[model samples]
Target: MGRDLSGTIRSFLIILALSTCCFTTAPPDLQARVEQLEKYYVEIKEHFEAKIIDLETKVVRLEAKVEKQDSLLADLKKGHKPLKENVDINQHCRQNATLRTCHEIHVANPSYPSGMYWIDPDGQGIGDPPIHVYCEMEAEQSDVKGTTSILHDSESQMDIGNCTEPGCYSRPIKYYASDRQIEALIQLSTYCHQNIMYHCRKTPLNFNGIAYAWWNDKDGERHKFSNRSTTCDQLAYTEGYDLQYVVDNVSLPITRIHFSNPFKGFGQHQVSRLRCRGKAKTEAMPRSCEDLWRMGHNLNGIYSVKGAKQMETVFCQFDKRPNEQDFQKRIGYQDIKTRPVYFSGEGRRLFMEKLIPIPFDHDVVNIGGAMDSHSGVFTAPSTGTYFFSFTGLTGFKGGVVITEFTFLSSRGVEEKIMKHSTISFSKLTTFNPITVQSTLRLQAGDKVWINLDFRNDATFRFVDNTIFSGWLLEEEI
Candidate 1:
């Protein structure tokens, strides 16, 4: 029994040893497993951290994109503001108001000669209204410019102010005062005067009357007076004058008056007196008292006429003034019949028959004119349609003539006129003279002169006589 108990003890000790070894090995394996788990946990934490960083980056990008879009929308909202309400008001006023009608009634008068209505449409009567409007608009616009900033701040106040209400139409809104309307009317009147009246001055007269006229009654007789003329003889005798006298009295100077000799009964003294008084001898015949009384009253019977009527007949005539044809044919005659001066020069003489220069590239030859050394330019004193003529004998070769002319202009801006022409010799002594004609539009301030340029070094000889003839012309009706 002792042996058996000893064996059991040995078995128990072996099992305990085995159990201790298995326990130590299990702990080492478990520790290794725990280390592997720790490594896996560290990898998971790093992955989670990386994922979180990526998500944060994506969120930041989206936020910036949203912010940019939001800013763009805000800017778009700010750019499109409404126009001012005053613009509407002004448009309405302009549309409703008849600026022209107001002007005609307020500023124009139908009767007075100096009144606005009588002003010619093409005359200076127009442009007054537009100028006034421009001035007022300019001033008001300047004020608007200065106050624009304050206006922007009070944008809400720019509303039309309940004008759309139903009762506002009948009830006069106190906004547009009577004084404002009066001022507007005055402005419109002035505008019409300036624009219509002033611009009308440029128009031509189509009808035949004084620009303005009026009728007046004096001594129970009605008379018409013209603004342009003050001739008492022009008074039409519609009902008063017994005999109308048609006189041959022109505005021009009278050279002479002729009358035919009277009949044998008329005395020389009566004929001479009739001639001096611009009456025909037939019209001035002396009559006996009996004959003169017979036309007006009943004569007493029985008594014969004491003197027979001295019958006379005379031809009324006047000297014929030089016609336009005569004046045109005469050369070298001053416009006022003054003597013409001759010029001696080395080049061909150039004459500007008209104040205006001929068109460019015109053949001007043998034109006669004297180049005045004393005066730089030719002086045309008389103001009329002048024929400026010059004759050139073709002795000069390779010579250029420059006619430097100036015309005084009452209206236009150009002050100087220039013309150029070349002179060429045909043979040793023979040359063709060029003629240039130009209708110069001249005013009172224009003067014409000639110059010479020689190219061949040869001395040019030209006649110096220049003709400036002008005839007085009536103003265009």
Candidate 2:
């Protein structure tokens, strides 16, 4: 027992010694210091800190310079203007302190032929100075790194098919008539690979930043220009076999082309035998590459049911087999949408302080059953811009005062679409008619209805001639 106790006590003492050895005690605060050295060390620390601050400032300035260079690179992709022949290529055009760089190769080549461009039908130093004619073409691309000849199509381009004529896959031709007015001729060959002729027309559809071009299709119904993003330029819309030419398969034809802006003398009158031009190729090619094909409208006898026919050409650009693959993609590319709803009221009395739903039950073409004719409410069929128009005729013979308000209903609150205010016809009460039309962007499943000014205790009745109609204008991509 004595020996066991002795060993246990010795082990306890050994453990205590090991614990003490593992961790050394913290040192006591030093009081002995040379006042001169202490001050010198502090100054040295401050000097190093100042150097660090200076380095950080330089880094910030360097980063800003890099960002400015990046912005200049981005502008190069948009497009470029002329620079002095002797000036270094680095100098860029500046507007309001913003840089405009030259066009980037990738940006220029991708969106090639689909833009509205101005061209001169007659080359420079020709008969007339330079009549700026609007032209359009579908942009095609090739690995064509060097110059392209107007007379030839590159074999290196992707194999589309057999060329019906020459100039199937050609490079974009751009000529500068002064730096300001440059002309571009895009080569979008037809499916049969023939140069396309265009029957140009002036369309006066400029409203609310939206332009429209209308034409009669083979179906005989006047169709609106389908390409929405471009101003009226040159459209390669002529297709189908010409009574003059015989061929293999019928090619797809463009019904019409529309522009967003109005040109002074374009599309207003039908120009008989309108003249157009193409670019020149080698030095041997004439500088003035004038085309001898004159096209005009042949609209003397053919008429619409309403006897409305514009002066249009018979077949400006003759084609036996149309390139449906291309035309179908460029024109009429958007889904032919017909989410149309129309409502009419036959002198129906409207009650005050109540939602007035016009039972415009005339089913013209309702795709998604959005317009409930009996309920007088139109639920949105899709998310897009829609056009709505309403016309009403009423007389204040009852000496009743009323205000009408139209509202669009959704999850949040009703938004006022449009309203008409007619004073009490106390002295003169006749069947006065009021009409209102509006284009609205609606979300999917949104609802629309009318109300007879509930807050104003208004009441009114619409005449038999009253009408409310709307159609989907466009769908968001």
Candidate 3:
């Protein structure tokens, strides 16, 4: 409005000037008219400026309202509980409700580039606190996507050449995040990798199947810079020579790096940036307690899993029964025969090598149904340590009674485990009993039984006092 009014006033003044020029004199009312037009333009400009200011204020308020509405809508769509108005969802990566890592952020918003971000690796309210970290979100041909944590970067070279051994120089790695936080990330991740770069001088990293440099992984295991090969000869020949390697065999993180100068060569070396990345296990589904434990679950209690046949809940005693089922594996049996069983070594068998399995025909208890009373064999339902005990009495006849616990492998091979012998030479020692116990580790499908043998050619008689018992002790993961 101000501009239009000014243009109209200028046009009117121009016409008056032209007319005055034609008459060679100015009209008396020309000055008064111009002053009146100027006053009117000032009033119009003031009014329009006030209106523009008012409209701008209204737009700002509307934008604030829209932002609030968007936040509420997003929460509703994700089925998340509405947060307080004072809470800022963007405070940390996990605070976004769905973005646990920077990789997830990049996935949610593809246009987001890699940079520093606040990440709560252990989730929003558990484990370690949030920490700032750099992320690498660049898309590559391999289609690999994950959050990367920088461990170490050698901005300048450092030489270590005074000694001559596999670990001539060792340095503990300084990671960007705490060890607990990194371990939490590894548990949540399906696959993890670390990139390593080494710059060597005149001496090669490896020669004639001997490595001069290696690093220890998160589990304190050593991994050579090169296998039993001379590949480093080609890569680390000159001062500027370098080699890049990726560690992905195990999901564990790296804790330290080492270099060696076995030949005492005139060479120097420097390690470049070490970055680790982990891909989230979005599809992880644990089917057993072992699986849960492997996934970083450390608590013990009743948990559900896909059992041998169907879904079932079992007690997870991670400290001992790591892979045990809900039912206890225990069995006890005894030979409850009315007639006396006789064992004669005179013509039946040799002195020590020959053995006969005890026929414990009566069962006292078979909890897990792993022991067979008919065959007198206890088959291990799972791989674990077990305890077995046997008690036998020489009824009335005096003889040397020897008994032992033997293991029958799945391959049908028998191995002696534990043995006990009793000497009953007189009537006073006729009732002497032999008790033997042992703890053995058995694999799944392995079988165990008791064997009887006589040390001498004397006959030994046994009654219903013969007893055998076994139970699972601890399960292995």
Candidate 4:
């Protein structure tokens, strides 16, 4: 449409001059031809000017149409909104229907990552949240600030509702996760709480130890070795000659584990699964090691639980003596408290049922001997196997009553040794006898004692014939 106005005018004038020559009125010479051509050009100029104006008008209309199309294309690029895709709320689960399997989320910012916890757990905060959808934005994206309540496809939606807007991963979140996340994260999210259209990235966890004592806590929290070794209830187990050790959460980078006790097991049948377990040092019972809950061991292997205190039986009564290491250790009993003394049943005093700490200076046996009569406690002079025997006489007022206990105190822990026996006072005139015998291993610094528990209103006393004794059978175990 770009017309050359001057060129068109010259062509028209040349054609008119040729036609005038045919009429034979104008001269063919330079002066005469020029004068005639100039006159014709002046007349055609008016028409050319009018034709140029018409072309210019057409150009303006085309430009307007192009602008309109450019605007329309921009609208098309924005696409549609409020996406609708069906999703199953129960897509993932392991133990419970609502709880979903998930990994812990890690990010550079202290605040949660994009799309974290957006899906609701429906009050079941049992698993790890796959993403940080529910987190707030610490700083508004300055580029889109206050532009609209509905954040754009590339913006962050801090508020609620189906704000499934696409967003970049460049910004920071407003705050930190809840306290539970700070302690440890288990499952990431429940199936029902997952986002329908959004996919959040999961953080990677470092690989841990080997299978021998592999336990897994979602965040590896249980793997940490604690400061205190035993729980309150563990302190009461004073039976069997078992070797024990405490394993704390480790601080190594490798995910593999390498730990085992000397306890022997064979063909899975005689073996016990060494499970990861824990408890507050002050608590009575240890809880399963949930931190490393998923870690497992070989079927019949002798293994130890990581981040747990273990009491394993390395030897039974018939086993050989302790190794050379144990031979060097001794818990010297200060005196030879062995005895074959006897008490008389002929003259017995009334003794009511009650707990009595032994070693009372008046108990008849060596008052100030190696055994402390005041507290009824005896310190293990050496690490050795000991045989303890107890005999008691009953008064006529007594019924059947025989329940006693032994206590061992060591390393700030007090444990109870279980003992049971039966004594009947069928013949009121004759003294009833009760006896209990036990063999155990004692460590140096350990304090052992017997507890006399009386039953019924009937009374009983150590007859002049009664006797209590103990001696080491072997040392080092």
Candidate 5:
């Protein structure tokens, strides 16, 4: 519309000039006609300029609304409830600061002691509600320095009397925080610690290779007191000491401590505390290297982050700053020595819908840890365009190797983005390999993977030299 109005104005000016020239060839009222024409042109120009200004203003407003709608849609797709009207998501924290975790609060205010504090992770008005968590601020100053948030702390000492029989165990540790919150905290942490102390008297930690006591760690992995060589010996002394053990797995948040009172009627056994705390990798608790870069960190090296699932060590590519949103996200896979066989037959045409995902089990370059080598799926760290390439050799059995590339959206919708097939005319044909490459735009939480077709009733296998790789091309701000 603006373009059309400008064209109209230009044509009017041209016609007015032509009229003025025609009148100049005649006599009397030429000067008067020119003055009137000039006045009319000025009025027309002002009218059109005003309309253009109004259009531009409306366009800006519409763009802003669209951007907001997009953000809200993304949150909803991630299973978040629509926010209440007029409520800003980032204002849930103290003083309207964007503090995502207790660690960030501690970093912002170093004087704040260990206590219950409210954190608005996943922002406010989303599915995630603001949760009050106990932050163990002392851990930052203690040994193994980092900020710690207490996920679970036993209320009182638990006693396990000598029950020589089996099946004696304590309850699973219940956490105050939600599972999502706990997972987020773990992702933000570099390490976790749990304090366990046993009050013992004239009783053995274990006997005859049977453990008298054990505790389940955060991941539910059981660790016996007798398993740690000197742990049982340390407990044998007259006075018990606090066994501050660093938790091996920081992925999970809760733990359960168990003690089988095998020394019933002989000695006593009691658990002092089962306090679990996660020490953050950094005070900032940035989720990605892009976050660190945005926070003004210029160093380029490996850094820990709260990844999509757990804590991930990713290389920060700060040396190259294509844009403010350009944080490194690259992954590569190779050394897939094992051959996976998929069988398909003519009658199995419908089975093509369920393509077998290829497992790129080795990673040569995983900068952002976005690719899961085990699952052969690349999860987008953020909404962005990414470059992906896969090269593989077919097995000696000359058969059709149909490969399908797929994209799983955040909304649980799967779309076939690309498909390639390598065929052999005969069994005598050898070295039939296939390669697929494409640039894909994916939203955060979207997954991409390569699948092989097993719909021809033949065994299909990709050779050992197969390579699958991808990297972030550009991020959407």
Candidate 6:
């Protein structure tokens, strides 16, 4: 037991020694110890606070950068939007052989023997060359009256075919020709292609029937004639063969040619003079008289006959009549002027009040009482400079009452005041006229009103009535 007690005492002594050592190392004054602890805490807090402040600044900068990046991305998206592809003939010509060939062919045959040719660099060729042909026929005025025969041949001396029977003789003979007939012979020789078909059942005593008749088959067909049948002696007929062919073949652009020689001299109206300039593919070639006439109408501006001076008067007047739908686009009747006024009063006694509610259309209302009063208001339908005029009179003492005249903007905001007019009792019963002029910067849908304040005791009668007239002088800047 004694040994155990000694061991416990020794352990307690060791613990006491350790406690004494800790107490001796600690600061003695509370204020000093607190100050050291506070210093450490402040240093640690400042370090953490600095780090947080830097992080916050970085966050703000990052946000701004993100916003800028987003704006750039939106701009890039807008800039990358696709654009429309414009048609480029140069590119198409380089890529398409038909276009190239058509250009080459046009260069080779610039002008036809008897027509006009307009070569548009951007226009597409109708089709392959020599595939289509145009045949023009005409009946000449001749004194002889035998069967008019036309023979086709590969050569000038060679005979291909001719009209049989009564020899197709007539005062005004009609004619027909085929593209195959022309193509077959035109390919061989120009002389062989001279033959054209003409047939007429009736034989006339005089050859003064049809001065001209002809036909041609191109991408489209054409026909022309000269009639000396009426007083005007103008060229006239029913639906022409050229017009019919053009209407039937909507796909092809057709042209017509007309020839008239007021002077019937052989030298004046030679075949060369009758020939027209023509365009096929991109080439200009000499065209027949009929083909030239057809194309002349298709071309812009005026055209005249070659050679004969009097025949040059023959020109085409393009149709310019307006269609029904075009006429309907116009609204309101013209040549009518309307003046409207407003009055304030009950039943028959109502007198002209301030001009408020200017009637767009004229409307009549009966006044009720002897001392009735009313107002008038005029609203401008559009923005423009305007002139205003009004006329009226007073018939009784204080009868003619003065009213406030004002103009209002589209927002119902008053813009200007018109002159205030007052009349004596004696003058009230008399007729008077008022006029005012003012410059207004009125937006569309603005309004102008006249406010009339009449006394109950005053009895008045208006002469020539009160009316408002506004005329647009000019557009306001």
Ordered list by TM-score, greatest first = 3, 5, 2, 4, 6, 1
- List candidate 1 segments past 4 Å from native: 1-387, 402-420, 425-434, 453-458, 464-466, 474-477
lDDT of 5: 0.56
Tens digit of per-residue lDDT, candidate 4, span 82-119:
21111122233212333211211112122221221222
Writing each residue's lDDT as its tens digit, candidate 5 over 23-52 gives 868676877787878787777766775565
Q: By lDDT, rank the candidates, best first.
A: 3, 5, 2, 4, 6, 1
Better of 1 and 2 by lDDT: 2
Q: Rate the local accuracy (lDDT) of all candidates.
A: 0.28, 0.36, 0.58, 0.35, 0.56, 0.33
Q: What's the alpha carbon RMSD for model 3?
A: 25.3
Model 2: lowest-lDDT 10 consecutive positions? 93-102
lDDT of 3 by residue, 123-163 (tens): 55544666555556665733445455543433234465456
In model 1, state the lDDT of residue 69. Answer: 49
Q: What is the TM-score of each candidate against the true structure?
A: 0.19, 0.27, 0.49, 0.25, 0.39, 0.23
Candidate 2 has an lDDT of 0.36
Cα lDDT of model 2 by residue, 1-477, tens digit: 446446655755565564445334524222322343345445554555445444544554454345445444554675753222211212221111111101111133333221112222222222223322212222234322212112111111111122222122122212223211111212111111112222232222333444343433223344433343233333333321211111111221222222222433232211011112222222331111111111111112222111012221122121111222211111112654323333333324442234566565355555546677666677776677877766766654444433343556467567676776665634444566677777788887787765444223333444444456677777643
Q: Which stretches of candidate 4 lie over 4 Å from their true place?
A: 1-353, 360-369, 396-398, 412-420, 423-430, 460-464
RMSD of each: 44.0, 29.1, 25.3, 34.7, 30.9, 40.8
Candidate 5, residue 426: Cα displacement in angstroms equals: 21
Candidate 3 accuracy as TM-score: 0.49
Error of 6 at 427 (Å): 10
Q: What is the alpha-carbon lDDT for the whole of candidate 1?
A: 0.28
- The model with the greater lDDT, 1 or 3, is 3
The weakest ten consecutive residues by lDDT in model 5 span 337-346
Alpha carbon lDDT at 42, candidate 5 = 73
Q: What is the lDDT of residue 369 in candidate 1?
A: 41
